[model samples]
Target: MQLVAPLNSSLRRVPPGWVYLAGLIPLAWVIWLTVSGGIGIDPVKEIEHRLGKIALWFLIGGLAITPLRRIAGLNLIRYRRAVGLIAFFYIVLHMLAWIILDMGLLWEQAVRDLIKRSYLYFGMTGAVLLLPLALTSNNASVRRLGRNWRRLHWLVYPAVGFGVLHYLWQMKVITPEGWLWAGVFAGLMALRFRPFRG
Candidate 1:
């Protein structure tokens, strides 16, 4: 296709490692804002929200890679692992911000919140789902797992669904942004079905 050529040409010029390095820019900016006291009155909440949002964006980006390659003939497979790892890194930071800054590592209260709050439960479930996928993102695991590797990575779909639900529930009122993310997640999932697999 006419569009594919230009897109592939442009992508070919940029190394996947560069994309990985560039992904750190958001983290750096967040750190700078935190140090400069620019995160407003509630720094913990701000940091947590920002990290969670970034994680979701990266998750969406990683998911998009397959569809992009299939429909647009743009192969960015090389960067999927980096995108996934960056997403996991942000997910960890998001949890840390909640545990250290928000809950002060109060296990009893944290457990109570997890049990009482649906949003917290969704978020925790999403994080737990991501743990195994993150652990096995390396090439060695892929070689060892072989066919099972694909099945293991399929966990990302549900993990992302849980993540979107977590985001929706966490919001006090569903905003347009929340709906947009949900729609995007739904569309991406739909694309994975047989009809769109072609």
Candidate 2:
């Protein structure tokens, strides 16, 4: 913990803006790949998958904050909001790519696919749950909502669970990486319980 203390002290000196800026680099990388015809044959699907994967990583990163602080003595409390909002940004882009590019804005086809694909429900449910959290993420809303703000933010746990399931179920065969993420999610959730921590 003593060794980590110095690193944590340096992290505290860094502003959350740095995290936000770093997040954009991936989006730009994804864009460049797609533009250069480097994103594989199905560019739309590639971009969508890349964006959603980025969002999932950020979502998991956001969820890990509390456990990291408690167990590893690392603090990133200030950047959680930025991490969450960036996750939501990629989520929105992922959905838009599916709708506009993949589905060609065809409401009928999109609806049919949504109905036929159960995994889509999990993804959509997670996004819908995140909407309120993103809307109230501002300082003004934090002051306005008071105690309810925390209650509303608790929606993130279910959103993350749905997201994990969405990712796993969409894959025909879950990869080792997917299983690892599931394990990480379970561990983080367990750490939130006093009994498990004990």
Candidate 3:
């Protein structure tokens, strides 16, 4: 408690806007990789993958906020909204990169690919679910929706699960790193439901 006291104290000085600014770092890195020719031969795919991965990381961060407070007494509620919005931004970019760079804006081809690439359905589902949450992630919506806002945000759990599935399905075989992410999500969900009351 004493250790986290100082940590939480420092966090109090940091504004949520700083979190939003820091979220841009991942996008900047991707851009750097692109200019430096370090994004692989398939740059579009690389960009798409990197964006999706970063989005997942932010989503995980958003999901971790409550559990971190509950299990470790570390409060990060102030930045959860920024984290969630950044995640949605990255997801939108990922989809756009795929549509424009990968599919070249060919609607018919994109539709064909969307139908053939079954794993995309998971990502699409997650993105669709996130849409409403993102649109309503404001004070006015919070006031208007009241209790329903919390219920609507609960969609994040399934959306994240589907996002993980989308990620895992992209791999030829689920690597240990991939399994670690899935395990982390599962652990967070467990802690959420059976939080320590001590």
- lDDT of candidates 1 onward, in order: 0.92, 0.94, 0.94
Clashes of 2: 0
Per-residue lDDT over 139-169 for candidate 2, one digit per residue giving the tens place of the 0 to 100 score: 9999999999999999999999999999999
Q: In candidate 3, what residue range of length 10 has the lowest lDDT sum?
A: 189-198
Stretches of candidate 2 above 4 Å error?
A: none
Ranking by lDDT: 2, 3, 1
For model 3, residues 71-136, the per-residue Cα lDDT tens digits are 688999999999999999999999999999999999999999989989999999999999999999
Q: Clash number for model 1?
A: 0
Residue lDDT tens for model 1, 104-184: 999998888778788988888888999999999888999999999999899999899999999999878999999999999
For each candidate in turn, give its C-alpha RMSD to the true structure in angstroms. Answer: 1.4, 1.1, 1.2
Model 3 off-target regions past 4 Å? Answer: 195-198
Please give the lDDT score at residue 29 for candidate 1.
91
Worst 10 residues of 1 by lDDT: 109-118
- Model 2 weakest lDDT span, ten residues long: 189-198
Q: Candidate 3, overall lDDT?
A: 0.94
